[model samples]
Target chain A: MSFEKQKTDYMPVELVIGQHRGLLHYIIRPIVGDENLVDDCFSAVTEIIVKNYDKYDSSRGTLAAWLTKVARNGALSFVQNKKYAMTAGDRQDAARMEEVADRKTPEDHLIQKENLAELKEALKSLDKLEAEILLRKYYYMQETRQIGAELGLSERAVEGRLYRIKKKMMKKMGGAIHD
Target chain B: MTDFNEIKLEELLKETLPETSLAENLGVINPLGAAVNRVIAGMVMTTITLNFLGLNYILPTVGIMLIYLGMRTLRSGNLYFRLGWLTALGKLMLTTLNLVLQVTPYVSLMDGWGLWAGQAVHILFLLFLGLGIQKAGLDAGMTNPKMPTWPVILWQAVLIVLALTGINSWAVLIFMIWAWVRMVKHIYHCAADLKQAGYVVPVSTVWFSAKPLLLAYLAILLCVMTGASLLVHYTPLDAEKLVLAEAIGVKEETAEIRSELISKGFPESVLDRILDEDLADLGSVTDVDVLQSGDNTSNTERMEGYSVSVLTEDGRVKTFVWFEYVDGKHAGLVDSVKIQYDEDQVTTDIKGRLLYEKKGETWSADVKFEEKSRTYLWFGDITEDVWSISKYSFPFMADSPRGYFTWWTEEKDGSPAYWSFNNTVFNCLRTPLVLPYVELPENADRLILFGGFGSSWGQDKFQIYATAQFQ
Candidate 1:
């Protein structure tokens, strides 16, 4: 109860967290795949940042800018940890499985897969969040706050995630089959 | 930026991450007590250290308050975050041990392995603690952005060890102040963190101004240390003469010297005989006096002769003084004593800040001797055209170089004895000439001069301020 410097309206971190919820979702969703996995990544990131909140130095960058870096790195660390967890033998098997799945594609499925892969690669050319939002809103259907919660996201995060999906989908629509 | 947008976490990692089921945001909870914990814990540690070994200071109320605070923090889940509290506890424990050992007889730093072990542990504790703190946040200098790497911890530990040795007390103080400042920054940020998490936290009384307050404490400590150095560094002192004068007391000034000289097997009533015999050129005077400092007769009956003084680097001075048996005066041990005088004050520049010791500030030395006793004295108490009584650290009564039964008082076991040479204690290396106490004389020039040939394990060299002119 004795920690305040002064009283203010609204939870302070929520203001910042609210502003960047979309970006955070964009960074996290793909890496984690499932909603529960997304929550795990999000929780660890927010905890690391919040616990070390006092260490934020504005000289390095603005708070908004710093948060972006932290979110990116936190997700990276989570994914990297998972990546390194598997033994070399397990990783080879996994890679082999992916190759086998690629070879088993239907003749028409191959064309479609190539089309989607090209689209995905083209989407990477633009800002990722806007692209992901574009793709999800147009293609994935209504992404309600309930879905946001299920993905361990604020309502704002779901909106941003859709924006990135759409933005990336647009790049694919334009490039179509540039490769 | 060029990475595929569709690339998923599952695809990148060959294995699935061990996921946590935690959904609630525990980080948002208000850290109301951490602010309180820092303030109260700091106050407790400061009070205990300043009060010294006096049992009265460790009031039951304070102890109870600390325990209560610890419990409160532990309950609130901040005990892990606030490990700094442990460091204060360590200082408290070590200081208490020093007090206890002082009262116990036959227990010394050399003999007390338990105490030495404790001191070692405290040093290690502080080192590891600093490393931990570094990990939890950014350094004050802003050079570090995250937790301390292993190399960072190693270097921090090394610096602390040097600081404990008195080789870097000032350096330690500087770094510590910087750390406190940085920690204060972290505290304020943490408060905002809680607020951001939707918690209404109250204003902290001490945490807001903790940085400036820490700096202020350091400033006051520096002021006290500076005053002490000026007293010892400015004056030109003859260590040999000062040691002899202090060892013998103002007996030579009064009729006490005559009585003491006769009682200890000196030439027949020199005080009366010298008055009637001396004209000039008093050469190589020698006498053996019954040492009062010794606990036993074997230690009591000791003899002494001339001692010499030499100027060391800067304005510092040292003495080569020794003591022998009253019967076997030649076979006695040599005591290496060092000193300072007020006649040679020098302005010191600390961290680019111009500082000067005042004139007429008496220079004194306080060698934290062994646990049993300590030898200390101030020079330059000129009275009635002659020097009055000056306390000499050489506890032996002008008898042996290896002083008989001198008071040996040590704060930490296995700590070096250089700081307590004559009357002053240097806070750091670079031969601090900080402050306080008078200077003792060397040779017959009626001058108090201090000059030395660095410390050595060589045979004890002795110096005399002036010949014993019993007038």
Candidate 2:
């Protein structure tokens, strides 16, 4: 195809998605650790980005940041399904469990809602770098190596910092979280 | 205390983590400023030159480091940025080598190739770095990014052209400055656009942090340059045997001729230094007029003796200008020598030799003529004077008492700036007295010799020379 034709063939959303492919891959790769599964998860994230491109509000957050959240959620869902597919004997029962897992019981919701406020308050006490490290590790599901590469630290260094930060947060939270 | 396990803590943290902008949260250093500094630092390295205290070396070193720092923060933005960062590394290494070269004695030998190589790397650096910024802006989804990369490249080209052509127009300089300012402003605007467009630059970690690295680099460069300056300014002396005339003794061989010249009122000091072959040239000395001489009272510490001239049989006169130091520790060797004479008197028989006192004994060596050609720009036409302006650097034998003896028909008026003088002490002990004399055609009257000295020990030293009429 001619360059002009190729340029014209791309939709605005496709162009946006193409620009953010690396970011999406970064977000999805660790969560979906398997290479094949990462490819599938990246496609799912891009699909969501395309479907919701028009709904994107730049005033609220940047396109890359918004796509990051979407990609993270998509990768996490993919991992959960992959685990269920490998472990569960019945696909229909696994689907039922997935739906039921998405919904919350009243007691669980009440307990989580009460703990979340305290968690947010505890997170505020941590520095920006500490918060970033924790968020990347837990929320984005990035590996220690990936987090180290981003934060300019060795993998072991990142792991040590993460452990210490978790300990600090645990002490600060006290009995706010349950085992 | 509640026994909260690792898995539960991870789940709690993941659930409560804010759903904010990942780019904002992940971005540690300000990528926009880094991108701008990368280009700005490139310009600063190329433009400014502070010669005093090795600032010329230090500033450029710091500027290149800044470019590397900026590249580290922005390399992940795009392929262009990645390539730019790689190019910045190459530029840094090349610049550092050139900086080290500046402080060594080999600078003169490597000057031409080093300049070309430095310019080539600088061009590549600017090209790649500018493109990186431009690409980042375009990829950031700004339709009219108004990138300054091409303009900056064009400006760089113009600068290289100006440098190669040796253009020294104030108007061009002012225009270039204005263009530079405009390019910087454009870079700032491009950065603002990239930020607005939500361009996320992932910063990479360096083994060494930027500020400390720069400070360390600056400190090392300053120390190295200072060390090099000391090495070149004061050439080291050989510590072996200590005799020049004895190693190649011509005094006994030409004792009869030298005695005759001395009887004719020739300075015995000047005659002892004249080589056997040169002593033969002065054999037919029919008349010699020893001029009145005095001690240099310019400063109390340095005591350079006055100039003594002797007329030869062929009407050519030889002048002996002695620069003896009373306080050898505080004295400086002669850096430059300029012989100016009236334009009318002309002959092509100029010879000079240096007699220096080392370890309580006087050793002699012939003056080495340093040849130089300079090309300068002229507005109307490329004149002969501008193309190959010839000059000479008079070599000095150090560790006084030291002095220069020049035999010529007449000296012409010449600018001190045009004189190519090297301030280097000759290793008289290891090497025999090797003479490569320059024969300059006599074409002037009233010869006035000028010697410029710069001492590390702050001792004021100067030379005074006068022409004597043939008796």
Candidate 3:
């Protein structure tokens, strides 16, 4: 009942990661790019987590969902800043590779990098609203209502929009998008 | 050789897959969790601050902090920042409630500049909160932004008018209820989010329950309502008492006069003339001092009394009679003059009217006055008019009944100068009690009798008698 006791009993970062490592990598690594950047982002995220550990209210959102959102924001900030530092030629190459990778191949099941690159390309093609919804839903794995509120739409509206966008993309890929 | 190599590679890939996935998920989840946690911590802290320091001082500071946090959350693309913004909003409402409760007593704080200031602050903050919600929604990519509709705008305008015009306290109460409902709805939405995300939490079910945050809000509300209700109920009584007290303070200084008559000396016929004619013209006496005695030796000694009468401009006469016994014999004069007025006109102005005006020109001759008992009683021709004789009583020396009357007359411009009548009656016993009454002329624009002290026996000791003129 008391926040004071809870505040002092915070789990260590290593232990939290060890316990929920699967969900963390599934949600964070795609947005961050590479193991080294992921490690960097993780440290930053844990620093925030430890510093504001007492602030979390279980009433607002699950600990996992809240943590995922924090990680995503940090990763996005990192990616945006990195994009600015890259040369124009490098940007164009990255964009082209991302686009070409979107084409499906039977060999994609064996090539995790190719699948990831194609997924990122497909995400980029989405409208800003749709992309954000999908990111909050699948990427950060937040609840539909939370995404709806963040976006100022009803929960049903968010759910419908996400469903339609996914279906459209799935049709485009001959139902290969989900797999 | 090829089959052995493939099997070893497959095992290695399976172990690494869960590890990499777990790491990526942790990276995504931890940061958001941290941000949300921080915002919730801020809310709890703010609630505690509000409880300890009171809403007035803490709310403004919290509101400003919330605005800052809202902007930062939008820029940072952190949903948890919205929590700070919402908490700030709740605090702002509480602050407003505090201000309203504090200022409503004694004067209409909602009138004049304070009203405008309060409205401006409310509108500005409302706009800020709306904008913040819209931007957050856009960032999360849920739906198009929609402004509040015309009806909502109109409702807000009405609320503003009611608040500024010093409408009843219930108007403020309605607004408070509205705000509470909205906040509760939003809190429910947040609770739903928490539940969906697999966190267990309970929404507040009772209003003003003893929980820390809710109890604080309830305490503030209770204090305001109790104070306001007391002010509304007791103000008029206090005002009346103040006016009456002022009147009594001035009236106490005047001295009363007393005179006595012996029944053996005055004849019945001569006594009748004095009571009927002479008593009528006696105007504005400070007191009628009376002391009477009877001759016990005379077997046929007649019981004595006095009567007083006043003829009005309407050609009708009004009379008052008093009767009493002296030295084992009934002897008195009812035709005694007694008037009581405050020395200070300011006290008169403050006390206002409290007496009934007597009408007619012919004064009663049959009644008699008594001096020994300091009382008035009927001793007229009892066989001729039993009812009249029984109803009349001697006017007490200490009692003073004074009244003022005015009527409306047409002015040169065809407008009516409405006239007012104010009367005050002082009844004496151990202590004097004053009663006031006022009347206004028909078709007058304004009839104001500023002050009259009522009998202290009434709940309101001073009655402000006023009537508006109508054409």
Candidate 4:
């Protein structure tokens, strides 16, 4: 299609909703300890994106970078307002709850749903330990200590072994990863 | 074939944007741009005022005006506009004040009552502006309504009174004008917003163009030029005169010589020798020649000539002259030596190897002469002019009181007799006429005196009068 025709085509609303749904769990799951608050923040971000679509300038920066800035600002404002509203004792209780929630293991179900057949096949070729470490680190977002414990090694040892494995994997894959 | 995964990937990246935008869509007056305008206006006014009156006071007045305008704007409900105005005004005021004070006596005002009054007024104005703006902002946040006009009027009245009673009346007048500018900006922004919203808000006749700002900047340049011109014309003409007065305590010729010797960093003891004894005024002895035989040859040389001139203790004047040279030389042939003194030091232009030492009650000199071969030639003329010579015979106590007197007078053991003028008991220590006399304790080893006063103390003259004990 010509550039003019492409520009004229109306953006599908389902596409925006589908994108939000796909990334919603991953983005909020790490930050908001409370599941209910995570859902609310996710909804707010989606609503803001829809409303301010006309103001977005393609020339200034990438969509992802701009969205990230907005998200961070929103999260900071939410935290500030929350601190002002809570009493000293209530804040302490909230903080403790957040800490406990953060310590819970992140589910790796999203990785299985998102990766393509080719990417999955590449991941399968890695030795079980290397595969499991990479998956836990990137997909589940687990801390190195927890990952190391599950794999039966010290965190430092796990890091060193992971570094070597990544290097080898990158060479074998020949520029498969975008970053 | 349609790729389901490719479609899914594209769909995952799309998200709805926020309804609220960072950029304000409502029409508002650009406060920063308006402040830039005011600053330009101030600069122009300052330049014009300086050109007409040869004064630099307008710069600070302009600052006071800007603050007034900023406060006025802040009261009118737009915080950003006030900030912009304040920033511009503050920066310009500081810059112009610094420049003006650096080049003139205006900074001396800081030592007077005007300084305190000015500071108090400035502090009050700043406090008022800050409080007014913050209160208005908080009120707006709470009420979700525009600022009431009465509070602004009351605040303006208070600000005006503060300005009028403090430092100068001009400061208050300038501030009032500034407040007017703020009100204008607020109205302009409000009107602009209404117009944007399709309401027909009336436009003002006042035109805010970049031209006014440019002109104002030109005026500042003019003020700077005027100040520089005044500085050039009014500064002292003779740097030497100024320096001399600072170095030595003399007001005339001695100061000149002191200035010269100080610039050269000559020794203080040498200067003191020339000042204390009237050696500068001794009579000349004619045709004094010396002949020397070197390893290779023999040579004869006659004295060029030398004169002694009496000067003030501070070396300001050279009153009398004593000349000596070959018999055929004219009377005007000899130039009187210039004596320079500063604080505790003195100096003269007798430039050759002449050893001067104070022993017991007398000053002794050992002179070594050389011919002008730039090498060791033992042929030269040596002339010694003693202004005052004292001869004393101790045990018999023959004291010559006509010459310079040096004695340990305060001894509790009655009178001690002197031997001979050359004897250790009869040696007369030379003290410069310009130096102050100080008493020492019975067991004191030495006495030292620093004479010149103030910051430039020995820099303008020679510091040459310090005493040391000889065992």
Q: Which segments of candidate 1 are over 4 A away from where they belong?
A: A1-63, A66-179, B1-77, B92-471
Looking at model 4, residue B426 earns an lDDT score of 12
Kindly list the per-residue Cα lDDT of model 4 for residues B1-471, writing each as its tens digit.
123433332222111111212111211112222333343344234323342222344454554454334333233334433453455455445545544454443545434454444444444443443343334334322223233233334444566567567755787668766765665455343332221211111111121222343356547745774445344222111111112123333335454554444343333323433332332232221111111112112111111211222222321222211111222221110011122212122122322211111222332222221111122323574432212221211111112111111211111232221110111111111212111121111111122122111122221111112121111
Q: Please provide, for model 2 over B1-471, each residue's C-alpha lDDT reduced to its tens digit, 9 standing for 90 to 100.
A: 334466677777676664333335564222244445555665566567765554565577777877776676567767777887787787778776666555444555556786777777766766676566556556544454444457666876888788889988899879887987887776565445444332355556455445566678777865765455444444333233336655433556567767776787776765555556655555355555554234322332344444555555544555544444555532332133444443334433445554555556665555544433334556865432211011222123435544454544433442111111111121111111101111121111111112122232222223343545554
**B2: Cα error in model 3, Å:** 62
Listed models, DockQ each = 0.03, 0.14, 0.02, 0.02
lDDT of 3 at B115: 55
Q: What lDDT is reached at residue B280 by model 3?
A: 27
Clashes of 4: 35
- Report the C-alpha lDDT of model 1 over A1-179, residue by residue, as the tens digit: 11132223233665445444544555466555567777788888888677765677766555644565567567766765555545335766756654554474366566555555544455446553343333333222224443332222345656655545545554555523322
CA lDDT of B156 in candidate 1? 42
Per-model TM values vs. the true structure? 0.23, 0.51, 0.25, 0.23
Candidate with top TM-score is 2
TM-score of chain B of each: 0.25, 0.53, 0.27, 0.25
lDDT of each: 0.35, 0.55, 0.36, 0.34
**Which predicted model would earn the best lDDT?**
2
Off by over 4 Å in 2: A1-15, A95-136, A144-179, B1-12, B19-55, B66-90, B127-149, B165-170, B185-471
Task: Give the candidate order by descending lDDT.
Answer: 2, 3, 1, 4
* Local error of candidate 4 at residue B282 (angstroms): 12
